[model samples]
Target: MSLYSRKAARLQLNLRKVAVKGGLAIGAAQAANAALQAAFIVILARLLSPADFGLTAMVFPIVFFVTMLQEGGLTSAVIQRETISHRELSSLFWINAAIGLALALLLCAGAPLVATFYHEPRVEGLTMASGGLVLLGALAVQHLALLNRNMHYGRMAFIDVTAAFVGFIVAIAVAAAYHSYWAIWLRGFVTIAMTFVLAWLLSGWTPGRLAPVSQIRDLIGFGGNMTAFSLCNYASRNLDNVLIGKFSGEVSLGLYDRAYRIVTLPLLLINAPLNRIITPVLSRTRDQEERYRNAFLSTLQMGLLVTVPLMSFIAGNSKGVILLLLGPDWIDAAPICAWLSVATLLQLAGNPMGWLYISQGRSRDLMLAGVANSMFICLAFVAGLPWGALGVAKAYAFCAFLSTPLLFWWATRRGPVSLRNLVGAISPFALVAGCCLVVVHLLQRSRPDTGLLFLMELLTASYATMVLTLSVTRTGRSCLAQAWSVAVSGFSMMQMRKRSSYG
Candidate 1:
């Protein structure tokens, strides 16, 4: 082969190696995090009351809003940029820090307003206490961004696992001592604080003098549009919590929050890594049409294969799942969990498309689509407010099912990927899920549908059915082939100690 072709092949191999290893590291870390949190919540639920969780849920929307501002979406700019200088990094760091401090102060000041809105005096302290979160989140963004840009996902995964461990320890201790909601809030604060410190230490980049704003105006513009999208998306996702805490009261909100977590935990595992890896890889391959399209579609297929059936099982057996995870004390949360799992299954279809826009430098499209999607979701939340948390979950699921098609079309149009390609990709996963749901429906007719044994029986049957079906499907075999290739490649550089410092 010619030297040029040889070089291209090697570069492609390296990228695949990095992407595969990064996915594994992140997947492993999130799995560990899920295990730790599952254990923590199991114990915490026994120690704390639903009202306690409700109090903190009231402050989360505001916290999430500032959390969006603190990053300013510059992390994406850093990763998506073909090149960046230390001066640019320094400027972004300072910008992030400034945003963090300003947001921290703002949140502290507005804590009272959050309490007032909820008519719950307990939320005031929780909101104010979360003031530091904005700062902590902001400070870490640039550091983590550089790591991602450099393909340091293994290190990032390590940091994530370590931070989660620390948070778990701190939360357990606090709960043992006080048995209050503060334990839950402090868990997050401590985790972010740890991540900020660890991120800086491991990231190896330090701020120098800031560059002139003119030097980064384009980046700022790109980031600002991304930030707009995030804000809208966050509002749509969290508004239910805000509304529930406001109208349905603390106990109800707490139940819904737990149910939300139950469904989202698996998503976090699949999504956290994919979202981190997509832009950096896709950005580099934008000019390579086939490569870009395959990366996005393959990622979607593998992610859905792992995630959807699991969520379907949860949705079908939410009562049993809840009983196993949170115990009978949260039995009433079952409907919310089931509906939320349904919503998640539908929404997962569109999740990967966010990065498609980012990699293509189409933040304008992202922001516009986010606005429309959020409107539908927000309206659903409002409509369900009268019926309470379960009502909200059902509404959200219905809306997601309706809006998902729009997202796919909007994201794929005018890009390397097309609506036809999307439908081809999604069709397989949908078929498998549809089959699983059908089997689950048939099984629901059986007697003795309660207790641990019944739950296990149903879970086993659902998964076994899914596995048997997927084994026969062409897409499933392809996904399996992808996994096999990644495994057999076994790049030596995947081991962090053996490789050069990615930073």
Candidate 2:
């Protein structure tokens, strides 16, 4: 073979190796995180009241909005910047710090008002205690972005997994001993402190004073537009919880919040990593429109390959699954979980498209799309409030479905992913899910006495295995081979290191 051909082959091998390592690291980290969180929730659910969970949930959106303000898209600006100066980085850090301080103070001040609105005076103390979480979150924001930009996902994964495990352990311990909402608040507090500590240790970068006055304007011009879009996007995403907490009271909100958490399980495992990895990768290729398009489509296809069947099986067997995981008291959340699964599936579709627009520096397009969607969703919430949380869930799902086309159009206009191609890629998974649902229905009719637990476990396992067998026939096997090779090599290397150390 020619020298050039050999070089090309070597490069391909290296790329595959990197992808495999990254995937494994992310997959392992997410699996660990999910397990710890699931354990925490199970323990907390039994120890604390739904009203305690609801109170915690009610504070989340406000804290989230405050976090958005602190973020102000500066981290993205730092990551996507062609050339980042020390001055600029320091300026960004302080900007975040200042905003965080202000946000904390504001949250503390508004504690009483928030408590009054919720008709629970206890919320004042809860809100005040949770206020510092925003500051902690802001302090770590830019550092985490810097880690991402440097492709230090292995370190990022370590920090994340450690923090989650620590937080979970603390939460469970606190709940078991105290059995109050203090456990929930302590979890947030621990998470923030660990985040700051990890970011500082892992990033190994320190900042000084702000940059030149001129730098601030340019950075904000880019970041401000992105932040505006993020604000709307955050609102659209969290509006249901916002409304639920306001109209339905804390206990109802707790039930719905728990259900929503269950619904986003697949999303937490799959979409979270994609959302992290895709932006920087896409940003590097933003000038190459074809590469950008292909990468977007491939990520979308891969995301759906996992998300679709997972959502389908979970939704189709929500009753049994909820009972199994959350126990008998949460049977009420079963239908809500089912309804939320649909919204999450659509979210799986739309999330990567945000990466596309952001990588292309089309922040205004994202902002506009976000605004339009938020408005429609807010209208839906107003119209659906009379029917309660179920109506709100349906409204949110409907809004998500309506917004899918808008997202598709935005992505397609800028890339080569046709609507037909997108639909075609996901068809097989959809078909499998449809078949599984049919089988479920038939089995239920024939064996009317079949337990919810048996049916849920059977359907989930059966459908998931079918999807994996069909989808992974070629690509999945290839990935598995690469993963196995990597694992074996890593094990061998560790053994050699131990022998060398002894010698």
Count clashes in each candidate, considering only residues at least 3 apart in sequence or on different chains: 0, 0
Query: Which sections of candidate 2 miss by over 4 Å?
Result: 1-16, 416-421, 440-503
The deviation in Å at residue 464 for candidate 2 is 4.9
**After best superposition, candidate 1 residue 352: deviation in angstroms?**
0.7
Q: Please report the TM-score between candidate 1 and the true structure.
A: 0.95
Off by over 4 Å in 1: 1-3, 444-457, 490-503
Cα lDDT of model 1 overall?
0.86
Worst 10 residues of 1 by lDDT: 489-498
- Model 1 per-residue lDDT tens digits across residues 164-228: 99999999999999887889988899999999999999999888997888889989999999999
> Per-residue lDDT of 1-503 in model 2, one digit per residue for the tens?
99976875575455444444565667679889888877777778889887898888888887778888899988777767777887788888888899999999999999999898878888788788766888898889889988877767788889889888888889888898888887988887897789899999999888887788797786787788888887887787677777888999887788888888888878888888876776777776666555556566666666666666667767666776677667788777878888887778778777777776677777777777778878887888777777888888888788787878777776657555566666655545455556655565555556643365666566666556545555545544443354356568556655776899999
TM-score of each: 0.95, 0.88
Q: In candidate 1, list every pair of residues with a backbone clash.
A: none
Model 2 per-residue lDDT at 363: 72
